[model samples]
Target: MTAWETERVAWAYLSRVTQGPSRVVSDFVERYGVVEAVRAIKSGVVPRVVAERVSARAHIDTAAADLDAVAALGGRLVIPTDDEWPAWRLVGFQTGEFGGRADTSVPLALWVIGGRSLLDVTERAVAVVGTRAATAYGEHVAGEISGDMAVDGWTVVSGGAFGIDGVAHRAAMGVGGVTVAVLACGVDRAYPAGHARLLQQITSSGLVVSEYALGTTPAKHRFLARNRLVAAFGEGVVVVEAGWRSGARNTASWARSLGRPVVAVPGPVTSASSAGCHRMIRESEARLVSNARDVVEEIGSALSGDDEQDHLFSRGDDRITGPAILVLDALPGSGSLGPHEISELSGVPMSDVRAALVMLEMESLVVRDDTGWARAQRRR
Candidate 1:
């Protein structure tokens, strides 16, 4: 084997020997390169931190077998050295804070199943995630947002499970758009068993990715580990509906840490399934997104430049389109007016007026009441 071929086996070995977010392993590889790091790790001549994390699995070197197994399944391991590796996404990922407990770092290798490149689908991706115990309203919202995004050539990333995740995958695919499913188990396995057909279809054009080696079973910790990647792959993460302790909420946390924009869809206050989303909004951890447009705007704001002004009221921000600005300027500062009145005053079409109002409402610059729409009270 050539040097790179040998390095590929080393990457596969490190991936199996160490779980995700292992800073020591990442640093070791960065310092000494993949081949040398694997030798030192296997020979028990590494740093204590690396030793602690890899000692248990160091003896297990199924690099060749694992590579062949995944290849047999029409997949391959994407290491950092690969030309298509998405180094841009991990630009400023602060692994230290996240890895303090899990003792992991950025993904060493992603086992991916799909003909399309990982960067291609993930380049303009957004994560639409929510509760497994979804309500009719929740599922509907997830589908609408995900479908709209997919149609606009933006890929949807999500955990491959029931409810919202399943809805996102199906919606993205329904529109003939690309989507990536970040699996908690091995890519070779069909998790949830029920979504076997869904997983199989995803691999047809989109991607099914995982950190776990082949044949690894799904577990709670593995799912948590998988959440980080789902958050990372997306430029932004949208939580459609989440309960008090949903995994979707956890993904949102990862998004925040990764500096990825976090958006949430509100549900009826009475619905237990939406409580998590509401809480995130209340805590200011996530921006409230009611529709696809709101999601797009937020994601655009985050990617455009410094995100500190994402929630700030900037008159020049591109997120504030001309129609929205006109709509805002047309509104009476003290009172309210209906859409027709606003459209007439702003010289914007009715359709544009309505769209602008929704965008304004999401930005907290406008509010709709029983009477009509009015400028929201500005904070001091």
Candidate 2:
């Protein structure tokens, strides 16, 4: 078979052999060798371990079914060999079996649905993850950090769940900035149905991606697995609002394992929701971020170029147009605005405001603060 055909068949076997989506492809390579693994799978004589893993685990078939379902839904499955695959996956994969106690997982492939190029977007990306049961403080802080990150021309990557995840994605999309959603389930299946429309919006404007295949339904453990991808794919992981034992903490641990920088947003000392972040900061495992500019300055060296500001906020635009520029102009020199405020000031519809903020934020021209509003960063 051709290389692509081999990859496709190997993926098919991958769908069948591994119980967990995290190791499906990599394990196939480890056990059978890449080429032989694909051949064995197509020949229907997959190893006994592979067969046992596939047959015994309900998730194995569910993972494969996800691929089939996505194919049926007009979504394409992207394997490692795919041209569009993000190169950042290598960072996580290379971090295997560290001296540290914590182990981070990596996915074999990504399933993406969106206009944005995952590779292009992640060239300068940062992840913002936090509690699902976020507080007003958490949500507000998440919005600001994520929004400002987007303004700096850094794509914001996160889990596509509620609270911090939803708000982070919204902050990026609100500004027409490129954001990527790393899902625990299939790209075709939108879990947390409340975010269905948001998922659609992401696929259209940014990217909705998964390591899991198409039809796989999300289980509790899957989110933890997905968290690794979120951490691994970015330059660093920022925790905006995580509680003690929050899943976002898992992502933070993964970031630590990979030697990626971690940033946390401080919240009310008495709030249970703030405990996790405080612990991270107190432990010195994460740096504390009070606003978007801090996040930028913290990771500023990792950013591709100082010229990102000129690219994002330029007025005599050629490719960029309309609301993106207006939102850029709307940002004040300090103290960020929430999406609503950005909308009001930019005269861009509330719907487009977030996307604009994301664009400007990723380019490093704007930032969001604890108040959850976008503001222009005060440059030296």
Candidate 3:
């Protein structure tokens, strides 16, 4: 095998033996090289901690079998050196602060099963995650935002579980857009079992990725560890609905730590499912997102090179047209007006006025308050 192939095999073996972060193994690989580390492990000359975890002979055999299985499934082992790897997404984890756990190292390799390249699908990705016991409203919002994001050329990334994650993936796929499902377990094995078909669809058009070896099962701690990968893989993360202690909140924490934008969709205050989202917004940990447009705007701002003032208020005059411009013109300079008021003032139909309001809001030319909508104050 070539050097890359040799490294792939060694990483796969290391993945099987290491339970959690593999910081020690990563350090060993960095110090002595993958080939040398593998040799030392096989010779029982490695650290006591690693030696106790794996019997050299059995572990090596398992690793070989894992590789064979992956090959049989038509999957590829992607290391950092691979051309198709999403290196940019993994950059923040370079310092080993993955999941905000200093002991845990970033994944050394990923088992990717998909037709499209990882980078191709994840170049402009957003993560939509929430509670498994999502309400009807939460699911609806997740679907709408995910579908819209997909249609706008942004891939939706999520854990392959029930509730928000499943809805997000299906919504993205329904629109014939690429979506990635990051798994806590091995990509070959479906953790929920129910999402097997959905995962297959994702792989056919996008990607199913995991850091684990072929047969690793999903454990409670594994899912927590996996959230970091989900957070890191996307440009921003959207939590549709999460209760207190929800795993989605954990993902949000990881996103914040990585300096990636975190957006929370507000739900009814009475609902427990939305408590985490409300807390995030209240604590100023995440920006509030009401629709796909809001999500796009928040993430775009983070990615844009424009100055804050310019990005917030500077839109070309020609960009606003038709009913949108009419509605903007109708708004009072110092006070808010409802959509109905704007419709009457602009001589535009109520339906057109509503549509215009959405467009205007996205452009930051208008602001909505409890009373109504008003023209946004332009930066001097």
Candidate 4:
């Protein structure tokens, strides 16, 4: 084998044997080159902390098997020196402390499965993350924003979990846009199992990536560690919905620490799922984003020197007009209400309410079902 391939295999082996925070592995690789570091670990001359956790002498065979398994799966191992690695931006996060984990470090290697390069796929990526138990409103907003971003040639990045993540991926794919799924488990192993099909679709058009070796299962700590990768990979992160203690909050924190812009979509006041997003906005940690336009503006400003006015939210004249606006606003986000109920709530005359509802229905701003009327799913 070539010298580069030999070193790549050794780095992959080290990734399998190392445990107890990524900083230990990162520091070792930094202090000694990949080949020399592997030799030191095998010779039992490494630091006491790492040595205690990594019994390299015992797991050498398994590590070799892990490399073989990845190869069998057609997975690519990308190290720091690889041309396809996104080192320019990821290097910044690796050198900084995040989530109070001083031991946190950049991944030793990334296992990717896809046809596109990691650097190219994430060149203009934006992460849309949120709760696994998402509300309908949250899902709608996530899908709309993700779809718009994809149509504009920006890749959507997210954890391959259910709820918002699934919606975002589907939306981007629906528009024939690229997306990247950063996984806590091996790229070959789908954690939610239900998203197996979704992950397959992503790999066909984009990429599925992880830091763990093949066969590694998803764990609580691994997910937490994986959050940093999601945050660091995107130029900015948008939290669609998150509870008080959601994993999405961890990603937002990492984005802030990495000097990346954080945006939060506001949810109804009564939703517990939106508590974390509201808190972030109130604390000035994240800007409020109501639609795709808001997201594009925020991300564009952060990414380029273009004038803000040049990228303003451009909703065409198709926006709801006249009494239709009042009637549409009167509708509840959840259940439907009749015209009389909407008239009473909106203070519009009954005659005007009926006329506005007709106009709104034709424009798809509202829908009339067997129960009554409700706001239609409008994508902006």
Instruction: Name the best candidate (by TM-score).
Output: 1
Off by more than 4 A, model 4: 19-21, 56-58, 97-99, 304-380
lDDT (tens digit, per residue) of candidate 2 on 1-380: 57776566556546445534434445656555656865565465765655554544423333345556666654666665455665433433443444543223345556778766676777678899888898888888888878878877879999989999999999988877778998888777778999998988887778888766666789877787788788877777889877888898888887766656788888889998889999999999899889878887776544333343322322322333446656665666556678887777544678778786777666665666778756554454
Tens-place lDDT per residue, model 3, 114-217, is 88888667777899999999999999999999999999999999998999999999999999998999998888898799988989888888899998778789
- lDDT for model 1 comes to 0.84
Best by lDDT: 1
* Stronger candidate by lDDT (1 vs 2): 1
Please list the residue runs of candidate 3 whose C-alpha ends up more than 4 Å from where it truly belongs after superposition.
48-60, 96-103, 305-380
Q: How high is the lDDT of residue 29 in model 3?
A: 72
lDDT of 4 by residue, 171-229 (tens): 99899999999998888898889999999889889999999877779999889888888
- Order the candidates by lDDT, highest first: 1, 3, 4, 2
Steric overlap count per candidate: 4, 36, 0, 0
Distance (Å) between predicted and true CA of 31, model 3? 1.8
Off by over 4 Å in 1: 95-104, 307-380
What TM-score would candidate 2 get against the native?
Answer: 0.71
Instruction: Report how far residue 22 has shifted in candidate 4, in Å.
Output: 2.1
